[model samples]
Target: MRQFFSKCPVCGNCTTVTSYKCKSCGTEIRGEFEPNEFNNLSKEDLEFLRTYLRNRGNLTKVAERFKISYPTAHSYFNRVLAKLGYLQSESFHYAEILEKLEKDQIDFSTALSLIKEEKEVKP
Candidate 1:
């Protein structure tokens, strides 16, 4: 048996998955099946998410624990969310607004207004 590295040949992306084959029966399956979200994450991302969760979603604490800057920790959290498919480029800004609203830093009306303003600015 040989081990295959899960990476893209052209782009060098690391999110590849292995296919299974039955040599005896000549049965084969190409491409990756639907796996859990965590499986799609790299080892580094998984470690970051674990530490972030351990810090109770506190980016400041996570940064202190990891000895990284707050912005770096926050970026890692966003990257993990993106890898898990919980975030999309178009929705990230809105989601951040929602998070601010949840934290009571921004009122609901302000969030709605911001969303409207964004929609108006969209080309």
Candidate 2:
């Protein structure tokens, strides 16, 4: 089976599921059903989310599993958070934090604490 996309590929607009069918009973239902949050994510994003969760929200483990740098994993995490409407990009200095992390100026725990402090300050 293929993944269901919630956006129109041609026009890049949101698409609604208009119908459903039961394979066992052959019963059909139709409506303008909104896709869930996970449905809005791409396959790669979903995989990243799953890995993050499986790792119990440990970015270091996620990075090792994905064979990416810690900073890159952090960036991917922020991107996912932004996509899910949990973060406002301009509110945090993600680039600076990532750069600092990459340069070994700050550890992961410190970087996370800084981000958490910023979030609390903003909201």
Candidate 3:
């Protein structure tokens, strides 16, 4: 099955579903319907999100699965986060923390604590 985009490809404008169909009755209805958050993600982004969730949000594992580097995975993850409005660009340095955590210089708890501290210090 093919997927329809939730945003216009040309102008980057948001899209709305305007039709509905009933499988049992073969009836169709049309109206403006808001797309859900999942519908807003592209197929590639959705695949990345699925892999991310499957690996328990571990970017290292996600990178390994995709045969990409950790930084690449971090970039994709950050893009998805921004698309979902959960994060903004330059909001936090995930790649730095991931590198630190991977080198065993700091654990997850310490990394999270440091992130929290950084957020506190930011205006």
Candidate 4:
């Protein structure tokens, strides 16, 4: 199946869906519809997301699977989070840091440093 282009070829702008058709029922809907954020993700980003999910968000496993460093995997993970609108103005919380440590996404030292940094910023 051919994938629809989410971006306009000429202007390089995001394209909006104006219509949809059903293959079997011969039904059609026409209106201005916004594409989801997933549509904005590149093929590589999707692949990375898939790999990360398949590994259950374990950065160590993701790094090993991609033959990259742990920090690199973490960086890629953060980038995906940003693309998905998960990383807003605030940094990761203390619970999130502990969760990452539990999931082996970050080492104990890294988690500690992040917690320390967060503490310093807040207090």
Whole-model Cα lDDT of every candidate shown, in order = 0.75, 0.85, 0.82, 0.80
lDDT-sorted candidate list, best first: 2, 3, 4, 1
- Which residue pairs in candidate 3 collide? none
Better structure of 1 and 2 per TM-score: 2
Which residue runs of candidate 1 sit more than 4 Å off their true CA positions? 1-33, 91-123
Which run of 10 residues does model 4 get worst, by summed lDDT?
Answer: 88-97
For model 4 the local lDDT of residue 108 reads 94
Per-residue CA lDDT of candidate 2, range 18-77, in tens? 999999999999998998877888889999999999999999999999999887888888
Q: After the best TM-score superposition of candidate 4, give how far the Cα of residue 76 lies from its true spot, in angstroms.
A: 0.7
lDDT of 4 by residue, 20-118 (tens): 999999899999998888888889888999998898889899999999878667766777777788875345355567667867989999999998887
Best by lDDT: 2
TM-score of 1: 0.49
Error of 4 at 57 (Å): 1.8
Q: Give me the displacement of residue 118 in model 4, in angstroms.
A: 11
TM-score versus the correct structure, for each prediction: 0.49, 0.70, 0.62, 0.67
Could you tell which candidate, 3 or 4, scores higher by lDDT?
3
Error of 2 at 42 (Å): 2.0
Q: Tell me, by TM-score, which candidate is best.
A: 2
Off by over 4 Å in 2: 90-123
Superposition TM-score, candidate 2 onto the true structure: 0.70
The weakest ten consecutive residues by lDDT in model 3 span 88-97
Error of 3 at 71 (Å): 3.2
Q: Give Cα distance to truth, residue 108, candidate 3, Å.
A: 22
Residue range 7-87, candidate 3, lDDT tens digits: 787999998889988989999999999988788788899999999999999999999999988876886787788888888
Model 2, C-alpha of 115: deviation from truth (Å):
11
